[model samples]
Target chain A: MRCPETDNQELLVAYGAGRLGSRETAKLEAHLAECEACRVACAAQATVWKALDGWEAEPLASDFDARLLARIASEEQPGWRRRWREWLRAVAARPAVPAFAALFMVVAGFWLLPRGAPPEPRADAALVREIEIIEATLDDLEMVKELSGGDRGEGARSL
Target chain B: MKTGVQQTVVGVAALEHDAQLMLRVREGDQASFGLLLEKYRAPVVHFLYRMVQNQAVAEELAQEVFLRVYRSRTSYEPAARFTTWLFRIATHLALNWLRDGKHERLQERLDEEGEGQTVRRDVPDRRPSAEQILLKRVRRDEIRAAIAALPAKQRAAVLMHKYQEMDYAQIAGALGCSESAVKSLLFRAYETLRARLRRLA
Candidate 1:
């Protein structure tokens, strides 16, 4: 049988919870009497409420009040200090910002150095090559002087 | 003018009741605050425990509930029932905590503490044998898990309805939803519980 509005499970919940008005309850009761389907549904709803009656919350700890008071005391510190701590906590909780920041610092550190102290001007490859050539030419000139002086000294000794 | 006078009379009467204690609390009366704590601590803790499904977290949240109340005492308005206001704070906190999903390990604590826990003598029991006790506990645990498995709003609706015995209006007030919405939450919640727990029921 199709469930009527008055006898549906949802209305039965209200009826069970004493939420329905007297007129509504009377209508639901009348419908329940005629419809076995709604009756079973209502009974199931009752059982659900019955099963809920089985669970009980455990008692609070003995020092609950004391601890609560202590927490309040700790929270009652200077407003600026508390806000600062909260700010720090919020920043620490976000990983993406800090991770990006560290990466940026590392990249910027490499990018901002003074380019290895401007590459020492005298250390150029072309200048080193020119100095080596000059040294070779001077050594050739010294060799020529020594050979010519030896020939002149031999002539004088023969005379 | 008549409605205003009636409201003023009602407000006065409410002040004579719990609101008076809160007013004293606002005035820095520690004893009044203690009295209020003594009265509401258990119910609030129980509500929080059922909401979070964890004992330690429930107690912590309950403590936070009272702390929030104390902190906001200066602004406490007696326009609504004090319980309504209290549960409003509570439901807000519990919902936020659930949304955050801060501590999954706390659920382990709930299981450990709740398993085989003794049923209160207040529950009408015709059979008082060891087997009966074990059966009742197992059944209770199953039901607890079933209710906890509900969505946060549904669980809050059920807790307020079944445990706190709150009417639809009060549940709506605490949940900041319409009465029809509260009914819908409870309806869907019971439907799911009935499906999962039909055998126990």
Candidate 2:
């Protein structure tokens, strides 16, 4: 067999892994007897493989399945609030979404406003009108009191 | 010859069975999902633990992996073996976690808790001496360090190959690489491990 080092190292890997067929294994063993480089490389790999077996993973937590199931359940039943929050999060993640939303709000605000109608009076202007009406009513009351010919002092006091 | 053929048939049938279970899951079969979860939970978690060298993070990542499997059930297609799809999700999440550098932050905590948390499966039924226990712990730590020193992809390849016992084609499928690339990765990874771990052996 050609030296697996320069030829087909995959075979050496397979042999080290114990994955090669018996025929291939026999052929490789025959080659190993004559090849010092292959022997050293294979020995090192075999040692590494054996050492790796010493690191056994700790057993999983007891609640692993329960926790996973709960997560799935929560995801499956995303309440309206959660759904809304998720939707907002998804929208926020995309810059264009917020920009388009702001643009839409501006456009919709203009579109929805009453067209061809007079604008409502400002708060300050309405306040002035209210004050003028109150003063006019008071003047009219005083004039009525005078026309009734009550005592002047009494009329003034009443006004 | 006959046994070899029989084993191949059995393997193919098992793959089909996993796909069938997934198909049922896609069709709103909750029980099938439970079965699938039960089957793969330990392997997935253990693989993550080996990858991250942190048990808590591994379990969390494993949950995310299963959660993804559940989430993607709607669009499930058995284009490949079920294990391949499962590991692909796991490998992606793990790689992302490592890339995000969360492992570095957790490394200190893992070291603090390492002694209390790690179990020794090889311990004899009779109580072993403190020296034996300490020796085993040191050996295990060395092996883990050696594995952790490998590049992410190579580390993943080694974990899947050694612990998961996945063949080259299956690993390539999970890793989304060609078979030859997988071989190259395993080759380099083993080379590094041999150099670091030969003394232990």
Candidate 3:
């Protein structure tokens, strides 16, 4: 008779938990009857399971409910501020949000930062200066025209 | 089996109820929120306590868990069981706490004889002699320590499996892993447990 392989821990765990299919369980059982090592392995796993049965977590204190309620009240007090922080944290924890935010900030900084030494001056101030320069030039032209002749219209007519 | 299908249908109905409770919670029903907290507080605390092996830390984390649930109430989705959602939050916190090395000092503190002394007092004094009581305490401590020694994912797997009585599907949903991954986790976890607790067996 060919002995079945018993080295599969998954099968053993399922067998121990009685979760294995009937055919698999039967085969493991047949192997277990004949194999000392597999049997010992199963027994050890079984013992671990048995020992775990006694391990119950201690009951919460009687005031646990009250304490939790108190916590809920405290959390509700500052409400929106806490909510914002939680939202911020959740958003920050997302892989793409922070990356996108960082990329945006960097692009924004590059776009807004002065490319060279601060702008020569305000554009409005430059415009005002140019207007003053044009006014002065016109005033100079008038003076030249007066210096050239008192009646430029008469001069043009004579020409 | 027909019964299995019936059980699935029942489970879905129960989950719908939980979802409705969450919906009420979203609607600013304080009582509904409190009801949820009351229902899940012990199980969450117990699961965390087992994960961290420190009651204070466990309780603190449990509070954070519920606080998170409340904080996220507005965005609550009824896609899964509330318990599954709750545990996923919890398991994330515990894993982070462990990763931050916060538990290392606590584990050391637990290792000291004095700390174990207090844990022993919590036990009802049933043993006839001090030695038997001491022995039993040590054995229990050993089991806890062995469990804590497993990697965080494996430990979470085993805790959900053994304590929560959650099957592979539930655990996978909670841990956000495949069912096969959960099986591997449990297999490795129990393998370590078997190795560590062999003498006891």
Candidate 4:
């Protein structure tokens, strides 16, 4: 059949394979009614396919199962350590893993690391001075408290 | 591990046994995982061998495909046929491997020491003479190169259709597209192959 402009060689191949539905089949049949060249071409293609049916499938190679089974066995780990080892191997194989680990470390450092002492020497000195000033002020207040009311005598305090 | 008795797979027994093995795989049984590989290795390797045109690469990729299934075993749901899922994973890895360019494939091959095994495999030579074998190899190589040169989706569609005998619907699932898309992809693939291999005919 003379295929339409939209109907290209693929349809011809599909039609040759008997894959077209009834409507398409009817259209092809009607087209073939008028067109001899396409009909011949289709016949030739179909014949080639029929001839190909005599061709046997290539035999699968030996050791295919043994090798594949060995691979699958290696993946199914016997324990957590083996699984972790596999993960390390996989990560080492791909460049993406170390980058991901680095990013993970960065993110974890920002979020989870302990909030501890400031590191600057000036800040440390300031903190020590601040503690001393606060201590002096507390001493003055305690002296005032002693003068105002509470027991101050060493013997009474001890008792 | 099961000792001393790997069962031979045949007929409907082979098909039914695949599902049973898949069930064991889901429950973390290593022997069942081995059985799945034992049963499907040839067809799977053949499929990849045709797709990639490099027998050694195909063999390595075939192993990776099964290993992928084993690793994903915990998430394996028996909603569909195991072979279907297996092939879908195979198609996905192949296409993605292609898409990821040359870099992703470095690790998925035989080690440098085993590169000796990658020497050109001798296909069955039924041709008349050594010269005829050379000519046939040239022709087969050309056809394979043409098929591989096809756009990834179309090449995959052609492979699934030709070797796996998957209908359009199954291909749609495997390729993650609609059935009509599968049809269109296959149609395009066939057209490409016909154009490339026309001289060989």
Candidate 1 lDDT over A57-152, as tens digits, reads 797799998888876766887999878876876897899978988999999999997566565577678898999999999999999999999999
Ranked by DockQ from best down, the candidates are: 2, 1, 3, 4
Model 2 chain B poorest 10 in a row by lDDT: B115-124
Best by TM-score: 2
- lDDT tens digits by residue: candidate 2, B30-128: 999999999999999999999999899999999999999999999997889899999999999999999999999888766787767855567556978
Model 4 residue A45 CA deviation (Å) reads 5.2
Clashes of each: 0, 0, 0, 0
- Which sequence of candidate numbers ranks them by lDDT, best first? 2, 1, 3, 4
CAPRI category for model 3: acceptable
TM-score of each: 0.66, 0.70, 0.66, 0.57
lDDT of candidate 3 over B28-65, digit per residue (tens): 98789888887888889999999998888998899899
Give the best candidate by lDDT: 2
Per-candidate Cα lDDT values, in order, are: 0.84, 0.87, 0.83, 0.70
Residue range B1-201, candidate 4, lDDT tens digits: 433343333322555567778767788787887667767887787777666656676777887887788778777766667767888888887776677775235535535546657456665656378687678667665765676688888878877776677777778888889988988988777656655655655
Better structure of 2 and 4 per TM-score? 2
Task: Tell me the TM-score for chain B of model 2.
Answer: 0.86
The docking category that best describes candidate 2 is: medium
Off by over 4 Å in 2: A1-7, A81-159, B1-15, B111-125
